[model samples]
Target: MTQARITIDRDFTVAEVPRRLFGSFVEHMGRCVYSGIYEPGHPEADARGLRQDVLKLVREMGPTVVRYPGGNFVSGYNWEDGVGPVEDRPVRIDGAWHTIETNAFGLHEFVEWSKEAEVEVMEAINLGTRGVDEARALVEYANHPGGTYWSDLRRKNGAATGTQQDPFGIKLWCLGNELDGPWQIGHKTADEYGRLAQESAKAMKLVDDSIELVAVGSSSRQMPTFGTWEHTVLSHTYEEVDYISMHAYYQEHDGDAASFLAEGVDMDAFIDGVIATIDAVKAAGKHSNQVNISFDEWNVWYQRGLDGEDQPHNVAKAGWREAPRVIEDTYSVTDAVVVGSLLHSLLRHGDRVTIANQAQLVNVIAPIRSEAGGPAWRQASFWPFARMSALAKGQIMQLAVDSGKTPTAKFGDVDAVDATATWDEQTGRLALFLANRSMEEGAEVSVDLRGLSASGVRSAEVLTIPEGGDRNSANVLDAQDTVGLKTLQEVGIEDGVLHVKLPALSWSVLELDVERA
Candidate 1:
């Protein structure tokens, strides 16, 4: 196999990227909520039952906004069940995962956790099985500052301190979660969901106009209602809603790393398709507001099926008496590469894609892993996300890379290298994240810094494992340590081109601290 080369030109610039595009999601599914963030008696837990260790790690991830309450779990969930006293909370069957949901962690708990983690909440209301009234009630409860029944109920539930105590100051909201899939509890057709979403959004806005609403788009690019769903939903609610939500998950069940790496190529097209649909809605001439996208749910999940029939839901629940960690997929090196590519794609399209979340936060296909009563450790996926979240501030610079192609089962021959660049003008630092998806050969990359003249490269870090498909095999209880970034020597400018070597099947971040010209 021949080596590929990537060139990043600093002259190309997109709009001033919104910082909220790098947001994350935390659902109430599996251990993501129960044991993941809200375990009360864990050695590291606090007075509010949130694990402080986990909170510290999440704060480091630098999530600007977090979507809450559900993925598929929201369709069947009643937000009212999770509030009030723990003894009054009901144990309901979670139809999405076929497990019992002990309503121990609810709306108030998530708000508290968001506060502790120092992130804003992107709340979602139940639209499937429930209607506009419940949705409006949730908004009034969270956003309204007293003078009403719901706000008074919140005060009674212990959120009363000051004017700022209202967690409903939440800026973003999703109308519902995945109402198009057959797996959804009250799955509706395009017309049904679009109309319901419009009404819900209208009512929600009446309660709080400052809050932005995201209409439910297709669950995936391959869904039966892919283009039709977005077109219809936007046609109905485009005027009332601020953005549309999209969800997708990457899986390599055939165990083809090459094919898995190529999945991101589809993600690129999927995002473009969504953007086209958004433009189509604008052309329809019903509204003046531009609808952005919230890729609220995404990540690689497909580990449990390989381990057997998911341990029989009820039996698995019985195994751990309290807050059992479930649906956790220990990430692999390949997963890290895909994640890097996804992040790059989000940055590249930062103009319209406002918010992006990496599925779950902990225990459930997340970057951080936690044991029920044991220590929490950063998974392999954590390094790239944390580094990007920390350094991916300021303006996003559009990068042009020319590279060779690698064929896959899903996507035909595709580029082996994908990358994005960010310039922190204040700090005088250029951050470049690159992923070389070649299974056989490395990338001989060239950096063409156009607008900003740099004297020399400051530092380079590459995150890779010895084996191509290496995974984190250590159980949650064990001390888990996987491969991470290793720093490289600075690159000197030669003929206005700064060159660096990117390893095959590797994810790298290059930080160039330049002297201002």
Candidate 2:
């Protein structure tokens, strides 16, 4: 058995847990929109074409904010196409995903759906093919309360139309999505994107000064222009934007499970590097305002697979189809553990990473999967996200984990036992998220609540490959119950210590009624 110990002091804390940290993305790609979230004829769909089954799952996952209408789709999207009567909405060719985009679900539908899902809308503007005028118009249309050109148009379009047609009042906005990448539509150099984002942000803010803006950061840490891109972009729009965007997708390449399991180490490094770059630019520019991170698009995507966008896509060769399946990577227990660890990384760095949306929240690399005209079920990755979003509250408690190391090809020598905790003073709750990366042994883990006393264990659950099940096993469309969280029944506190046994390659969550001494 592998042994590990963690010491957590209630007083030694990170920052308060930002609610937006438990966010998800909804892009107009593949089945994410048409059949995923909006299936008009689905047995459980509402009158508005919103899938009640999917909405139930979404609400259960507890995403606080949702970024809408693009990953690459937004770059070439004309917002005007998605508004007005459903019959009148244009059916256009979406170059981003090589699909026919029937603008059935647009800005108005999204805002309505957001209300049903009980999440704030994090809107992204088009700086790729469009510019400042469109950005300002979007802000005006979504925000302005009364009689004006865009606001009047919004009212005329019958948006929440009745006695009191209200504005969406969306607060958070992204300047663009991944313009730093060569793959992005209307891709721009760091300086070019910086200038466009800055001016657009300026104009948008002029329309509605209350709105918060996020500038475009690099698509990934591995981007050739990563550091320089952030520096140049921040140098230009640091004052204008409240946050900068970051996107990343991880997958196990060549079947290296050990390296794949240590994904949190890479995530931690990526966040730290971004923070360092942000600070460097701040120091050079001598700015007082802090620019936080909106890690808007992130997940374990199998981007090299057939459905991945990395493949050579010929729109002309393959006839454009509506809502064609794309990048819908089915996750396994191994993937789920990595995802839980990644969530720990984000929670550990909660001070800087205020907003994080797991990419393509429905069918495309999402926690909840729904089949067209069928049922919606929780993926293996869903349990951790749902549990963490529910458990983490108040402040993120900094933990001192003393554990042995595990060697891997990608991120060398990561801790065998990794953990993070949250302390909610008002609720008198302490939640611990732990990961055991050892593939061949159970871990005898002890958590030292040195300055605290636990009343009792509220809940303890662990996600691992079930007995007689392989780690690669998944909950596909047919057999949707292959992998899920099982109760960790043998957990207790004795003399200021929490003792629990974690199986190899597992992710666990425990909640306790804890009070500071």
Candidate 3:
């Protein structure tokens, strides 16, 4: 076991990390939209059928914006099928996960729930089956004030019942979801998707200029079209769209702990590749408008294969109500360490990456899990996400850390000490998050407060368990418990450098009060 050290300099300053970068995603698949967030009969449900408990958790997560409705499910979705009266809402077959869509909770319900959760809605259009017309109508319905066709329809549906509220004020909209992959219902070639995205974005913006559109890029780094997909798509829609959407998920397929720890390198490389791609597109077009990347879908999945037998397609329908807890990953301490590294990577690239969401918000491969008519539990991945959301804000600071590298299955050799820093201007505080990926030994880190000097360290919090690989042993009704922010202690500043000890295979968040010297 080797020890690593990290040193932060106060003189180095980087881009300001946008608060919206901490956003998350919520889909209708599995329990994410059903019992997970909209259980009408639940004791904590509100008038619109949103679960108050889930809302409370969402508020705690402090997601700036939430991507709604579908993953692969959005490709085959029909926007009109989900609107209007509940009784008349049609029941369609969900081809993405082989489930039935009740259509009971549609666009209206989601908007109301977003208001209740105190988060902005990031809507994705159905480019798989539907196209520009449907996308335009949906945008008009949400952002158009009144005196228009869709806005009037929204009024008819009770979205405009009181005080002339602007029915269509949604600011963010996705052009489509995952159109580059073969698994998608309406997968398109780079040329096809680019052209479609250009046309759709043009029409969407024409309808509402204030709204921003995100074009679909590669789904993951391993995709055959990873870099090329982004280059070609951005080439055509460079002037039309505001951001390019990227999706990636990490999984320990061979069950190697070391392999899982190195996945963050892949995430870092993915973001860098996309950033270069965006720059290339801008250079090629000689366009002044800079486009950013949206990591709208990302998390650790693949636990389903290990837990139970894969259900056959024929039996999937019957299992809809049962849901059977598909992809319910019981995250271990190792997963948290990797997630911390990923969050660090996002903050490091905060300038180019504006919006990011952790795949599904609840149940199906998510941080929050629940059983129908039962209590919910936070997974091991939940703690770091909650902590980052709470502590990560303001400007991003570049950290200089000296560390070694280790080879692994998925990401090859990667740095052992991975971290990033954020400074909150309003609170006059600096927050540093670190992930020690070494499996055998802890790292003694020395951090230098750059630019702004502090009198003394305010707090140092560690989120770790006794057993390095220990997982959260929580059930539906059991008391949800796991390792999180165990301590916050004041530290002495030695020669303007603060020394702190970070546990091996652990994640630590240190907060310091900053003052101008």
Best prediction by lDDT: 2
Task: Estimate the lDDT of model 1.
Answer: 0.79
The C-alpha RMSD of each candidate to the native structure, in angstroms, is: 2.8, 1.7, 2.6
Higher TM-score: candidate 1 or 2? 2
User: What does candidate 3's lDDT look like per residue over 405-499, in tens digits?
Assistant: 76677667777778888887788888888887877676667676656777666777766665332533322346466445567333457886777
Candidate 1 per-residue lDDT, tens place, 1-517, comes to 4345545455567756677876788887667777688788999998778999899989887888888887877888899888887777888877666677888788888887888888889888888899899988988888899989998887777533222345457778889889998868889999999999999999988988988998999999989879999999888998899889888888875667788887778788999999999998899876678999999988887755545444334434354333344567777677788888888888888898888988888887888888778888887778778888878866788777777787787787888888888887788888888888886887777777766777667678877764433442322346366466677543456876677777777788887775434
For model 3, what is the C-alpha lDDT against the true structure?
0.78
TM-score of every candidate relative to the true structure: 0.93, 0.97, 0.93
Per-residue lDDT, model 3, residue 505, is: 75
lDDT (CA) per prediction? 0.79, 0.89, 0.78
The parts of candidate 2 lying over 4 Å away from their true place are 159-164, 305-317
